[model samples]
Target: MFVQEIAPLAGSLGLSALVAVLPLATVLVLLGVVRMKAHHAALLGLLVALVVAIAVYGMPIGQAISSGFQGAAFGLFPIMWIVVNALWIYRITVRTGHFDVLRRSFGKVSDDPRMQALLIAFCFGALMEALAGFGAPVAISSVMLVALGFTPVRAAVVSLVANTAPVAFGAMGTPVVTLAQVSGIPLNTVSAIVGRQTPILAVFVPLLLVIIVDGRRGVRETWQPALVCGLTFGVVQFAASNFVSAQLADIGAALAGAAALVLMPATRKPAREEVRAAVLTGVATEQLERPEDRGEVLRAYLPYLLIIVIFSIGQIPPVKKLLDAATWNFHWPGLHVAGSSGKPVSGNTFSLPFLNTGGTLVLIAGILTVLALHVSARDAVREWGATIHELRFAILTVAGVLALAYVMNLSGQTTTIGYLIAGAGAGLAFLSPLLGWFGVAVSGSDTSANALFGALQVTAAHQAGLSAELLASSNSSGGVLGKMISPQNLSIACAAAMLPGEEGTLLRKVLPWSLGLLLLMCLIVVGQSTILSGMLP
Candidate 1:
């Protein structure tokens, strides 16, 4: 048994920690500094992780190979599975001309491009994330943004930024659920705590969106719309996560925001012509031209409706049981190294078959969408092939990032880095969100981030005399902010936008805003711990 010693540089803890961080640094340098393509950068990062895991961590060759394969397999199944299906759904709509009708329907609500971005990319995407996650929001929203007349770069940027706020509670509350499991906190407490922190930011996200899209004067002009949108989203997100199932939080908030746009006059603001003129340079006005078929528009939207229904049915007891019955779970052997006391150091590994996963649900929706659109089988197959071609690079990027994440976690280097923060005692509260931010930045999913650090946060909270639930929830909430700039998500957004080779520019644009919001989340968590005890669960 190799018990880790927590010295600065003379121990396995210190060495492992440095080894873990090297790959991440390689990612930043390769992508941000060298301006390499995302796929190439990701591959380089994965190589670094593999090398460090073998040489520094002293992990057996077979165990290391097994870990990488496991990570890559899991990445492809659920994560890539969701992306492909969601993108396929979008492709079907475009190929069948139904997306034109949906675009027109949105325009009928409000001709303002800014408002459309808010409604579809932010609000509607949140709903999709709540329903299917695993890259669904980024997949759906980025394409919508592009179709709405934004340049691919701008569309990618907008969708990535907008997707951030709802991520922690996305996909039937997976992130919070993972947090609960890892921290050993009651699920209700984690939900309430995350709810308390998320909605505070939700209140300000619309204002932030306006600022990002159209600067201060533009935000001033759209104040009423921003207020209505933000409040509706924030209020429902706050209420549903705390009072109802956390799984329903983002979906409820999104529906409420969409409702505000549909029913509330003040929520649909007409962007001033002058502001539109300034930002619409080099853009063909044809892209923003509204469609004329309202009935057809509703019909065009059946796929998304079916997505919600299918996802909801899959969550039901009997349906879920049948699905679970079909899933194949396999335990990984030979990777568990026993401790001195004879307990295994590594946890059990299991694989749930793809057909039973959230990704498969999205895939089924894509197929149903194709059928509803009445496309011929040949055309449908063509659409699927084209969709795969479009997203191939992104699939590679997601796989690489997930592999890097697994290497970090298994190497004990992440723990070494966490222990550095945990050593800060009371100061750990301020750093908690940052740790989670780093986690999601690497992993691109809050569920993975929470699983990586939730227990660590609990331990740090106990040592620091802080609230364990609050800290754990804070980690999840903070993870949302990091989602905006995650390389995996950025890659997905760029792919959906058809904006290849510009991932770095998008990252630079969104990084400041993401970091600033993360700081605010940190403050909110600290305050919840010290000032507003009753406010926390």
Candidate 2:
């Protein structure tokens, strides 16, 4: 058995880390520089990861291949599954023309585009994120915005930006749960800390939404509703994440905000009697379209509802056991390499059975959508067939990114990167959020980021004489911003918006904002650690 050594690589961690970054670089270059599409970039990046895993990391070929395959399967399933089903729901809505009604429903709320953005992108999207995170917010909301008359680019950018605030608690607070597990910290303590830090973000995100939509005046004009939305979301997010289930935080906050919007009158528009008359008539006309038939819209919504139900059920303890029982776990044969630490470091693989995985549920959703739409079985088969070719590149890209991430994690390259950054000491406080950003960028989930680096942050903070809780929480809070730039995210957004070649363009637009948010989060961490010591749990 080959042993892993940390000390020998300590001196060269920086270089090794750079070597580990090659796959990511290859992906960006192929997509952004060469103008290649996501699929091609993904495949190339995957190939690069395979090489690096075997050569640079000294991983056994068999183990490396197995690791790659396992990660690819994960990428295709739950992560990609969420995206596919979400888009399918949207398509069903469009196919049935319910989206037009959905759009009109929003118009009834407010005619101002900025408010619409805040309501749809910020508030409604958060609920979607909370329910089914893996890119659900972007995939669902961006399309909703596009349908509501926002330009496709604006929809994509806005949805990406708006997705940031609730991500730490996404997938039912799975990130913090993972962090707690990895760090051996109390789950409530981890949840509370992350909760505290993230609400600061929730407060500003609604304002940011308005600012992005129509600048400072727009924000100022709508500041009341924005404040109400932000405060409600922030307060509920803080309370729910700490006191209740973390997964319910975003969903509860979002629902509250949306309810407030529905109840609150729009302050921007003066009611015109004629326009009022038209609206009243419109409502009557809409109601007359047959209440029974309109219920079909709700029926069209069932697949998504089922997805949430199934995913949630799968997460329950008893159900988790059943689901896990079907999972295939195997020791990797060849990838273990001896490191200076004298530990066996290698790849592993796990495959949950189709009946138990989120993907299986999503595929079931797709089938239900076909039946609900009354589309022929042959047409449904053809639709899925068509979906495969269209999604080929997206699938390739996500798989590649996941493989690179897995390689970095299994080969100790990620630790090398973490060590280098942590060596910055107390100055690392200002960089804590960026660490989360980098982790999320690599792993594509804030939860994954927390799992990857929560322990590292704690270790680094202790070494640097900083508060470990504050720094660890900063990782979760700050990582939310990176949600927008993650390749998995970009792929999901593009797939949802049907903007395949525009992922880079979408990335470029949101990249600056993501960094800006991270910087803000870092400052918050510094303050919480130094000036406000009692702020963290």
Candidate 3:
């Protein structure tokens, strides 16, 4: 088998690293600057990666092609699978006329746009992220905000920003689990470090959400509730991740935050007369027409309740083992090459874990939703087909991006780039989380980002005399910010908002927030590495 080369361009690491970054740069410029569609940008990025791997990196064309196919297949199976099914479930709810009841129920909670954003976009969105992730929170919450009368752009932006805090522990803590596996760190230790870092952000994310939703006025009117929500979520997340169970940390935190919101008394002073009149008129219309019924409310929430139950069942060890027993695992053909580290590169394989995967659980939840709602199988099938049709572009974007990631990784281009960044030495602590931000910005999955950079972060931390756990955890915490700008996520937000060609606008809206939060995470990580070294568990 052919071994990989980290510095393939005249043995110059910097030049090799620049060549390695061509694919990522191509995507970013095409999407963010040139305003290309996400799928088109991803395709162009994939082509650039292929050229770099074959020509500059000297990877055999056959192996590069095989690796790309492998990554694309993975993107379709679990990633797209989850998104499509989650949207389909939502469609079923809307079709059964239950979503209206759900919206009205939320209106009953608080009709203020700012409060709605906090309750739905931030609090409920975190719960979705904790369980499903992979665009589920954005897709579901953005649509909910739109139904609640937010402008499409505002809804998309709020959902994207709100998605940040829970992301590190998202999809049943998959990102942290991947970090531990790749970095050779204990799961609990990595989880604890991440817990310490992200909870700080979590405590302020609701405030950020309110500000984004209604600017300074939003924060002014809602600071008490926002603080209550954030503090509750952050504290529970910290406790659960460090003291209880990392896997269930976000679940506990989300529940606590939601409970806190439900229990807290609304104390906002009355709006100005006209504004209060408009708000009351709207709430009166909704309540008069929809009239929330307890059963309908339960049914409105049943799909998500089923989702929690199904996912929890799938996580049970014995049940997980039984389900995963049927998983398929195999090396990709024609890609059995090794990396510069003497480890197999393209030949690395993972179990498909079809039955136990989060996507499959979501799919099962959708099926059960149909049964519970008593919808005809024909209608359910139609909605599923419609969900797929709507996500065609998203599928292409995600698949192409994953293919590019795999090609760069297998050809050793990623290693060259990573090593170049790691060369920052002691200063690398400040830049460590940015590495994860870059990875997630490209791959569109925090789990994938952790898989890409977790080991690299550990290696760099050793060289720089930094805390490996802290830096590795920073990779995940920082990646949460990158999700807002990820092309795949942008596509999901756009589609959910029914503004397919407005991705650039959405990216522009969320980019500053993403960068600002990433910078904060960098400061936190740098502190943990030096002055706050005592914080490491």
Each candidate's TM vs. the true structure?
A: 0.81, 0.75, 0.85
Error of 3 at 492 (Å): 6.7
lDDT of 1: 0.72
Tens-digit lDDT string for candidate 1 (1-537): 333222324565556566566877887677656868767877888788778767776666776666666656655766566657666777788888887677656655665767777887888888778765666687777776666567777677778878877888786676786677446688788998888888888777777777777788758777777778878888888887898767668878888888886676754556678866755443443444543665787777898788767866776788878888888766665455433245554433555655566668877877777777788889988987897897787678766766665555554445555565566876777888888898787657787677657766875676577777788888998988888787778777878888787778889999998989999988887787778677875
Two-way TM-score contest, 2 vs 3, winner: 3
Candidate 3 residue-wise lDDT, 1-537, digit = tens: 768897899999899989988987887788667878878987898899999999998888898898889768766876667667777887899899998788777756765677777788887888778766788889888777777666788889989999998999886676887677556698899999999989998888899987876678667878898899999999999998997656578878887887887676762333455543433222122332456779989999899788777866776789878998979988767777886877774336744777876678888888888999999989999999998897798789777876776777778776677677777887998988898898788667897777656766765676667778888899999999899999879988999988888989999999998999899999988888888888878
Worst 10 residues of 1 by lDDT: 1-10
Compare the candidates by lDDT and give the number of the best one.
3
Candidate 3: residue pairs that collide: none
Computed on alpha carbons, the lDDT of every model, listed in order, comes to 0.72, 0.69, 0.80
Using lDDT, rank the candidates from best to worst: 3, 1, 2
Instruction: Please give, for residues 90-190, the per-residue lDDT of candidate 2 as tens digits.
Output: 55556667655664555456766677788888887886676557677888787767665566777788899999888887755656755664455777887
What lDDT, from 0 to 1, does candidate 2 have?
0.69
lDDT of 1 at 45: 81
Off by over 4 Å in 3: 111-113, 130-157, 170-193, 212-222, 239-251, 267-289, 345-347, 438-472, 483-512
